[model samples]
Target chain A: MSVDKTTVAKIARLARINVPDERLEPLAAELNGILNWIAELDEVNTDNVEPLASVTGHALPMRDDVVTDGNRLDDVLSNVPEGASGFFVVPKVVE
Target chain B: MSDLLGLNAVAARDALDKKAISAVELATAYLGAAEATAGLNNYVALTADHALAMAAESDKRIASGEAGLLEGLPIGVKDLFCTKGVSSTACSNILKGFVPPYESTVTANLWAAGGVMLGKLNCDEFAMGSGNETSAYGPAINPWQGKDKVDLVPGGSSGGSASAVAARSALLATGTDTGGSIRQPAAFCGVVGLKPTYGRCSRWGIVAFASSLDQAGPFTRTVADNALMMTAMASHDAKDSTSTQTPLQDLIGAVGDGVKGMKIGVPKEYVMDGMDNEVVTLWEQGQAWLRDAGAELIDVSLPHTKYALPAYYIIAPAEASSNLARYDGVRYGMRVDAETLDGMYEATRAAGFGDEVQRRIMIGTYVLSAGYYDAYYLKAQKVRRLIKADFDAAFQTVDALLTPATPSAAFPVGRKIDDPVTNFLNDVFTVPANLAGLPGISVPGGVTSDGLPLGLQVLGRPFDEASLYRVAGVLEQAAGFTMTPARMAGGAA
Candidate 1:
């Protein structure tokens, strides 16, 4: 159950977390401990158990589709670190 | 002046009704106290101007005979809840400078209930830690220091609210409980905290951790005060798809009903190893008192209790990793200046979140990763169902379940910092309720012989807060929880 540097980097990227190369070993160890802890759940005889997605058994009752949302686009964009016009500015992708 | 700092909600409400003190006056007094304790780092941000303005409006409403139960009371809103046009950072750098244009439904509900917001309190980065130490702002001091010690660590994610209430900085405060964030800290800080049924309050606009387990409740110095805040906070919000449609009842009156003839279930499985002796003793004493008070104590078995902690570790992080994925640099949240978008995301998240938050996120990502999902996340979900079945079976015979909030009283700062497993285990007894989405309340049990506070938690069936209140109120009355951290910290000096 060892998390190598490559795997650690990939997981970090997927999680959007930045892990310094120096801290990777310690981070991996901590993650290993957690994974080991989680491995205990495997010993349980859960063959008959159903997956509990939510505490309440009720399904999420969604509303009818509607075109409504917060009308404060300018207000929202005001907090953006980088913005142009009314859209969030980001690095060019296709270009 | 009746020591308004320690007065319960009933007394505070009566004071406002009698015009003995105006909402503005109470808000000012609390604001002053909070400002004085700013060194403790209990609050990430304070809106003194907004508080005073709201208080003034509340006073006007009182003058016009339009007061509600929470009217004129100043409360601390946990920083995790998005405050419209205000900083709702969740005590993390990732969301720095991000002001949500819309208020969290719960926040809007509080304001609608006429409660005045004093400020946003500090919390663990995205509500991820057991001790407030994980907060990016810095850990909040317990404010209960004696001659021999430095200030203590207020327990986590809700630590700021607990510290603020304990320090008398606010009359009441809101807290979100995913695991034991509210109850564990309330016990450590000697305050009352309630984590109502999972969907009891709307999670809309709240910075999500584990959506299935996350719930917003209240923290206050008294059980009645906790009820006041909880009632105001719990509502059927159509916006939150999972919000319960259960009619909010007057839990204050239910508390007066007492626990006579109630079947109080003490589950055998929750008596975990490594629990402190004093907590065990206090739990026994609490049970004895409940039994003497005409309540029947039943020994129930929740066989899958051991699986809860591990299941939660898998499930909470799994959900957290997903919920937090939305906080990429392209959004309004903090973004690091980098050469590329991927680099920007990495830099921003690395610079933004605290260590513990990062650990959880990484763990969450790993568990939910492609190959491991079946072995970890999916299996944990199945175990989660078993854990719920354990409670469901226990509740069939008993009206409510009771357990100690934490294994021990408030530990010194840095006690469990190095050992993340021990810190995670601190929520062993409390996490089951969250996993099962059951409502739970933590009341002051008794102080240890060493003088630290002890807490007992009562878990109830879904949407059955009335039973939880009845049982908790009985224990609260028997416990006679009069010692606030301020009393220990020395009053107003």
Candidate 2:
């Protein structure tokens, strides 16, 4: 129901966002307002209701198993942050 | 010809068909005007060469008698919609250099129908904010200004499209609504916007937000224009799994059908405590006009209305947190060439994302976190179903529902920015339709007491866009308020 400084710090870490100590108070209040708004949902009796992910009752339709999107490799990698020899270059984790 | 910005898509299409103006000429005029007022930040990228080429092809097709209804028409594609070979950022730095290898189904469909693309319009970063100020590209200026010269914000995340249409920069524009992005901005800028049924348009290649609720629709100057653009944009796409297989309706045919004998439902619950007086007054006036024109105004109940805003906050952010996780430095976009993987992701995301975007991502991550999933995300989904059920039950009694799009007119840019909850609450009235996957539209009702535009939404059953357009057409005619931004010389306010 309420977001404390500790929870704020925890959430910030999980979300990979930086919130200075001074900003935590305001952030906590903001998070509380959202939580308070969300709390209103408790008033309803959803006792037997099914949770909905998609409003349309249909299942996620599957496409052909074949890979059709292979030719645009150059365009796809055009904006890649870092790459060498057609593979994305990242920090050597194993090394 | 210069006044063509006021023309709806149908009228513009008609003008093009009669050879009154070529598509290239029409697009050129808007392109010229948009470039002339480049300071508004309405465009992230303008495909002048692409648009001209497409226009020429449209002319050739028309000459060959192969023209479709939208042939040779110019449209502003929202930056959120993936444009092949064009920059699509959703106005966020995180996606700074990202361009989709393929076009989004919606964009492709528009092109297939012979619609010319003017370019990608600006939007809130990842469509995160109610005001356009959250865009990393810079906030789009509301082309219309108040007398004191305050810079008015064209509402977000479709702010650029709304502002561009208002400024006569494009004949028509596309907008996405996860919440009220399209309609709210349309209202603030005094344009017409329609968010069709959630599955009405395909989402393939659209940068994801809340996949369940997000939908792409149109922003235009008139109700009929919206109808035309909607028809052109709406279709079943095999690539987008959620796209409806249901047949698309003839929106233009539904226009003249009017609101006669229709049961217009006004839910009492949407009249929330502490609503702005102008919105309340205008909503009543809009109802009266409908009743006078033969619509039977009836009280309908969406008893779960109070739950909607909260439910939306939980669901949207929970989904957003997961969807945005793909934006790590490993993929395309602004990346910090860090010494390590952990360092890379942290530095990339921290530097790339804007404040509001980061805040949302944080909230989203927290809600969907391991210990809190059931209490937040899953519980919200259950409430989401209940909200949909409320609309389903209400529709059994009323033909369509009407409500204020927002509790008030557009506030000053920073008015609610610091207050995230208040900002999220702005989507309260509009979120139910998204939750329910219903077709909804925001029509210009009247101006607020402060002279800002007023918007009221008409909501229809799933895949029932025809019914939505008829009611919108009725209200649009009765309101008789046509807004244009060229009237405001310097884009002040």
DockQ of each candidate, alpha-carbon based: 0.77, 0.67
- Pick the TM-score winner: 1
TM-score of chain A of each: 0.82, 0.80
List, residue by residue over B43-82, the lDDT tens digit for candidate 2: 8899999999999999888878888867988888888888
**Which candidate wins on lDDT?**
1
Q: Candidate 1, TM-score vs. the true structure?
A: 0.97
Tens digit of per-residue lDDT, candidate 1, span B1-493: 6455655667878889889988888888888888878877888889999999999999998999999878989899999999987899888888878788789988888898889999999888899988888787888888665445666778887999998988888788999999999999999888889999988899999999999899999998888788777888888888888988878877878877888898988888777778899888888888998898888999998888998999999899889888988888786788888877888888888887778878888988888888988888889999988888888898889899888999987767766456588889889989999999998999988887766788998999888888888888888888887765543222644
In model 1, the runs with Cα more than 4 Å from the true position are: B486-493
Tell me candidate 2's TM-score on chain B.
0.96
Candidate 2 C-alpha error for residue B117, in Å: 1.4
For each candidate, give the interface RMSD after superposing the true interface residues on Cα: 1.3, 1.7
Compare the candidates by DockQ and give the number of the best one: 1
